[model samples]
Target: MPLLCHNGRFADTLDPVLAGDNPSFKWGEGLFETMRMAAGEIPLMHLHWARLQQGLTRLGMNDAALQRSVLENILRELALRNECAAAGRLRLHLYREGAGLGFVAEAAPLAAADHGWNERGWSIEVFADARIAPDAYSSLKRANYLPYLLAARRAADTGVDECFLLNAQGNVCDAARGNVFVVRGGIVQTPPLSEGAIDGVLRRHLMSLLAAAGRPVQELGLTMEDLLEAEELFITNAVKGIRWVARFRQRTYAHAVCKELYGLLGQPFNNALVAP
Candidate 1:
């Protein structure tokens, strides 16, 4: 059986067993982080916590220290329980506690962690019907994922691996599940956070690595035309380090830059299998 941790407490099951009602479910008042666990430890956890702190602050939730402590303990215990000491995925979910149809009294925040053993190179196309709304909450991985869900459905139905979601301004913001990057003329460019892309942990780390290696990377505007002309395209997420896109509709991409960057990323961790 999979083990789960609910608000610092371990349990044999994953159900929340809420005391009252879950405001996260009734409304979309929740944020989450999906992290990659390597050798029982979460790499780049500090960044994940930093982003989580931002979400908590944005959602008007206090007790950051307590929440971090709870997650830390749960991660350790769950890692051991799941036998994921070598590798796994850790998901942290935080939500406001409330009741009734509308948000009632604001109580202490509730959180949970699902740690599991693991273990995609994706063919992606653009999703056009829905565009993400730019707002304070847009950068956070919140529970309000209707747009992403719809895009994923379209991808599955259309025989593609994933779809890129554009922002309200019709700029490429993110893929269905990760941040998008485009490479043209050996220079890498990704949509800025201003474009409503989530501040992905791997995205930040990979950018830093690229900069340190003296390779040029820019946070700039990206359009469908830019992608069409790019030599390479890729996506980054915490769980999957980096996946070079094989195809985007009629356009195809090469992995020359992705291979170099992927090798650079794996150097420190000794993870040769990260190449995709």
Candidate 2:
């Protein structure tokens, strides 16, 4: 059986892990981070940690036990317990605990570091049922994930790999499970955080990698029209890295840039260190 680390303790079952009245379960009052583990460590941990801290600060859920070193140790132990220490995906969830906060960390093994990069690209469409509104909480990866959940369901119902969500202004905000990017006129662009896109760790790192390689990405708001006119489209997340979009509506995209960017993501760079 897989073990989960809850408040630094191991539990084989979730029956006693959370109370029935837990705010996170009842009201979705919590935050979480999904991370990629490579060579028994998290390469982009710095960025993930930074985002977690920001979320905690934003939600006023600061707790002394939620220190970086402590959580890192918990995650490492969980990975080891699950026999995924070398390569895996890790998730750290923080929820309200007696007016303060508590955490649960879990890990799952992957075949390799590049396990889920869909080489043939993904087929996606725009989800028009709802609009994501830009807010102080929009960018945080919180437990109140109804919108993305519904979008994911829609993707399944429609037989599409993913769905693009638009902001209240009817502009492309992000994808159901990742950040959206477009390549147009040889310039890469993505919706800014101000437009309600999730502050994805991979998105931020990819922007840095591109800038370092003399291919800076523009943080601009994108529309369906802009997407239709683009040369290529791709989505990003920490675990999957990059997934090119093959078809969006009647438009088809190329993957040359996506391939190059994926290569860039695989290479080691500054601050892309193993979690300490």
Candidate 3:
């Protein structure tokens, strides 16, 4: 079984003492980071930490030293405990601790992601039941995750790997678990944060990489039509890195750009190396 670490020490399980009144369990008052670990290290750590820091700042948290210590030491310990040090995914959850009845502000830990999931490609479809609201929390990996959970369930029910979620204004915002990108006429485009896309670790890395290469991708408003008419499509997350979409509805896409970008990112995941 994967080991559990609570607060700053290894534990048999998540704090059983946490009363049902815990804000995270009661109101989803928290932030989290799902990180990629390879060979006991996180390559995109800086990006992940920056994103988490932004969320923490918004949540009124300021334990910078505790955050750094957990990132540097506890992450490695959790990997080793789970026997996934060589190749695994980690999720650091921060919830308000020691608060009574109502919401509190503090960081906490939670276990978490996929390991080398990309293979041939993924099949996707749009989720239409609900839309993600354009708000500050939409950009952070906060605890209010019902929409994503429902989208993922829809993908599962439809036998697809992922589903695209629309924003409140009916624009394609993001995928169930990551950022969405569409390649059209050799130019890549993704919805801007204003449209309600999360500031993904892989998303930032890929955007910066493209910018450095002088073939920068665009961030703007997008629609279902944009995805339906695109030549290529892919979703990116800290754990999965990048996975091209082979089929979305009746349209099939190529992976030339996705593959090229994956290579540009130094091929972070190697599924073959993961222990069964």
Candidate 4:
């Protein structure tokens, strides 16, 4: 049986998530991280964990035991699986544990592209639906993914690859699964965190790379009209890495910038090492 972290130790029997009702499941009372576990080793785990801790603190449910136990179990599992002997993405989850409620870290998922079935190129729309970020939990990757999942489905049904959700303030913040970057005139721009975009791990990595390389990856407020003038558009996420947005509201362009960003991810996931 797969192991689970509970309170501060490992349980070998049925997962608590399967055994009881978790508020995270019903009320979305927990935060989670979608990790990139390669060969069982998650290179950027420290960064992922930092974000998790912050989210827990924000929710007033910080548990040092849960954190330590999760990390220990992940390392142990990696050793058992010999994941470091190979390379692939792994996702881990954590939920608050208690009576009538417990969070579960499900089995790892395959590392694959979820957006833009980019055969030759990818196409997406500037979906005009507005979803203002909930300030109380905007920063957490909590269990309430229904809104995002639903928006993505709407886009897919429309024959579009993905959706760019502008915040209620009417600025490009992020997509259903990733952050948005608008490139034009040799400048690469993404919405600032103030725009209410989730601080994605890959997004942070690319920002450091772009800044260090002198690539001019600016974070600023942007408008829909800006999409028309954008020379190139792309979305960045941990799983998809970087996908070029070929079409934005009848505007089309060559994805030169996406190719550049994709090159950053093709190399490795390093926190301190930033390169052009």
- State which candidate has the highest lDDT: 2
Q: Per-residue alpha-carbon lDDT of model 1 for 144-209, expressed as tens digits?
A: 888988998999999987899999889899998789998888899999888989888888888888
Cα-based lDDT at residue 56, candidate 1: 77
What are the models' TM-scores?
Answer: 0.85, 0.92, 0.89, 0.79
Each prediction's RMSD over C-alphas, in Å, is 6.2, 3.9, 3.9, 5.3
**Best-first order by TM-score:** 2, 3, 1, 4
Q: Taking the tens digit of each residue's C-alpha lDDT, what string does model 2 give over 104-189?
A: 88898753434645756799998878899999999999999888989999999999999999999999999998999999888889
Report the Cα lDDT for residue 16, model 3. Answer: 55
Give the runs in model 1 whose Cα sits over 4 Å from its true position. Answer: 14-16, 63-69, 98-121, 267-276
For model 3 the TM-score comes to 0.89
Model 3, span 1-276: residue lDDT tens: 446666666655444545777778889888777776677787788887788778877877654535565456777877787776766667777776743112212221222234443657899998989998998678988887888999999999989999999988899999998999999999989999989999898899889989999998999899888888999999998787788899988999988888788778774553444334
Candidate 4, residues 1-276, lDDT tens digits: the string is: 555444434565364434346666667777777655444556556677778778777777745645455564754464354323133444455566652224444333334343223435567775566575637566567777765777698788999888888787888788888888888786889888778788888888888888888875788888888877989887777755677777766778777667756756653432222222
Q: How accurate is candidate 1 locally (lDDT)?
A: 0.73
Model 3, total clashes: 1
Off by over 4 Å in 3: 14-17, 63-65, 98-117, 270-276
List clash counts for every candidate, in order: 2, 0, 1, 4
In model 1, what lDDT does residue 74 have? 68
Q: Which pairs in model 3 have colliding backbones?
A: 94-108
User: Candidate 1, clashing residue pairs?
Assistant: 39-86, 40-85
Question: Which prediction has the highest TM-score against the true structure?
Answer: 2
Instruction: Rate residue 223 of model 1 by lDDT.
Output: 86
